[model samples]
Target: MSDIDLSEAVWWKSRQSAVNGNCVEVARLPGQKLAVRDSKDRSGPVLIFSGSEWAAFVAGVKGGDFDL
Candidate 1:
């Protein structure tokens, strides 16, 4: 899918996020795309991803694929 306007997207951080505000916010874009941005920098850059890519990333997180 092509780029979609994100100016109206409502970003939300995980409920499990800590109080330090060191987290990312996620927004659901049109055409099943997802956008992620740093909570500490709301006006900063955003990383966009397709539905499948986001799903895989979520799966990885659930499976501890990125555990240190």
Candidate 2:
């Protein structure tokens, strides 16, 4: 992730986020990569994923694979 340039990355949070601002922000980076960071800590560590990895995660989410 350090090899990627995020200086101009545009980040946005989901509309379903809590009004208190407890949410994560996602940014689409170059080369089909995605970056995620905590909204409360914009300068904190970020999680980066490949396009395929993101797609699988989203599919899992929609499939309720993450449900407790």
Candidate 3:
């Protein structure tokens, strides 16, 4: 949250990402958190999440919980 420093965060996109540059980048922050941003716009908005939150999201993804 407010305690995490993102200025020096090193963001990286997934190797699985396609070459079309249509993917998001992620950075591991301090205190078991993560920072996510759009790869197409580095200077755009960012989203932060706690460790548990990220885990749940990943689980949902793998379980197809977000599938429509």
Which one wins on TM-score?
2
Model 2 ranges with Cα > 4 A deviation: none
Query: What stretches of model 3 exceed 4 Å from their correct place?
Result: 1-3
Candidate 2 at 24: error in angstroms? 0.7
- Residue 30 CA displacement from its true place in model 3, Å: 0.7
Query: Judged by TM-score relative to the true structure, which candidate is superior, 2 or 3?
Result: 2
Worst 10 residues of 1 by lDDT: 1-10
- Candidate 1 has a TM-score of 0.92
lDDT of each: 0.92, 0.94, 0.92
lDDT of 3 by residue, 1-68 (tens): 56666789999998999898999999999878899999999988889999999999999999999999
Candidate with more favorable, higher lDDT: 1 or 2: 2
lDDT of 2 by residue, 1-68 (tens): 57898889999998899999899999999999999999999999999999999999999999999999
Candidate 3, residue 11: the lDDT equals 94
Clashes per candidate (backbone, < 3 Å): 0, 0, 0
Query: Model 2 RMSD to the real structure?
Result: 0.7
